[model samples]
Target: PAFTLESLDGVPVSLEGLRGRPVVLNFWASWCGPCREEAPMFRELSARQGSGDGLAVVGILFQETNEQSARDFIREYALAYPNLKDPRIDTGVEYGVSGIPETVFIDAEGVVQHMDRGGLTRERLNVGLEKIGVPAL
Candidate 1:
């Protein structure tokens, strides 16, 4: 799904902007416990790839009202990846997200390789990563 949402810093982020790299779309909310659970894993994955050059781990805020809470979540998780605001749940509906924490792995060609609802485990995460051309963790 294509979308253009503002970043925490109020910069626009679009799926089209990240064309050639694999993307992990994480749909989450600051109030969600499970979203918090998988945050560090996403953080580490993005960090290992190094600063927007490799795999793109993008967070799409879901059902969240307060921007400050989202900011706090990023700060607490030490997330280096871009997190987009979706106050109207536009991206969530586009991605068919029924739950707070939904993960979608899209390949370099913008094809969705895998999708999972709820929190992530290393095993399940590896399965998705493999589809996006990353080796098993």
Candidate 2:
């Protein structure tokens, strides 16, 4: 199921809002070290494509951190993209997220195109973006 959540500033965001753009929905936990390591890559990707056509990166903070912690993480990383708080883990379960740092690539039509179940390197991210027709920066 497609999911929706609120950003730190209470903006409503949903998979539908991302339609017509390739989206990378990442499930992560604040306590996961691997998640921490891969976060910068996601941040960079989002920043690079934020103003580009047909590309978006939505970070889903899984059932791990409070709103304050999630906001703190975003600030610390200087992440410019929107981050969603999935406190109930419903979105994670819907996306079959079994662990931290899992990423799902959704195409322009909101179809799940690819799933990466572990840490994401720059190369992996580029490959996924390329697959989804999002030009790598």
Candidate 3:
């Protein structure tokens, strides 16, 4: 179930490309209520984490209608991280995401450290960050 999904802006993003870093892979949809609720928190965490220091916040758009919808969602939330489109949903299947707003924390060694199946708060996100060997937001 390995994938190299393209970002809204057409940038290629892959797990292999982000090998050395701890990854926060969030599966969400524009139309999902819980996903909307946690979008801002994800944005804040992405801003705080940036793309340096061996950490990455990657948004995997699931069950989204179109690229424009995903782009609009990202713009509305002011998200700085890459939002990748999982059209076939194979990536989501591999991650066992049964619903929107699921999150997977992958450690530096490419191990799945934590899996959360709902909207995330700053506190819960901090715990996941800690589990993946990163500083809390």
- After superposition, candidate 2 runs with Cα above 4 Å error: none
Error of 2 at 87 (Å): 1.6
Clash totals, every prediction:
0, 0, 0
TM-score, structure 3 vs. true: 0.93
Which stretches of model 1 miss by more than 4 angstroms?
51-53
Q: Whole-model lDDT, candidate 1? A: 0.89
1-137 in candidate 3: lDDT tens per residue? 35799988889999988888899999998888989899988887788675565788899988888777777888899999998988899899988999888999999888899998888888898889999998887
TM-scores of all models?
0.94, 0.91, 0.93
For residue 95, model 2's alpha carbon misses the true position, in angstroms, by 0.6
User: What would the per-residue lDDT of candidate 2 be over residues 7-119, giving only the tens digit for each residue?
Assistant: 76888898887789888888877677888898888877887674766688888888775677777777888888888878788889888888888988888988888888889
lDDT per residue (tens digit) for residues 95-137 in model 1? 9998889999999889999999889998999999998997655
The global C-alpha lDDT for each of the candidates, from Candidate 1 onward, is 0.89, 0.81, 0.87
- For candidate 1, the per-residue lDDT at 81 reads 89
**Decreasing TM-score order of the candidates:** 1, 3, 2
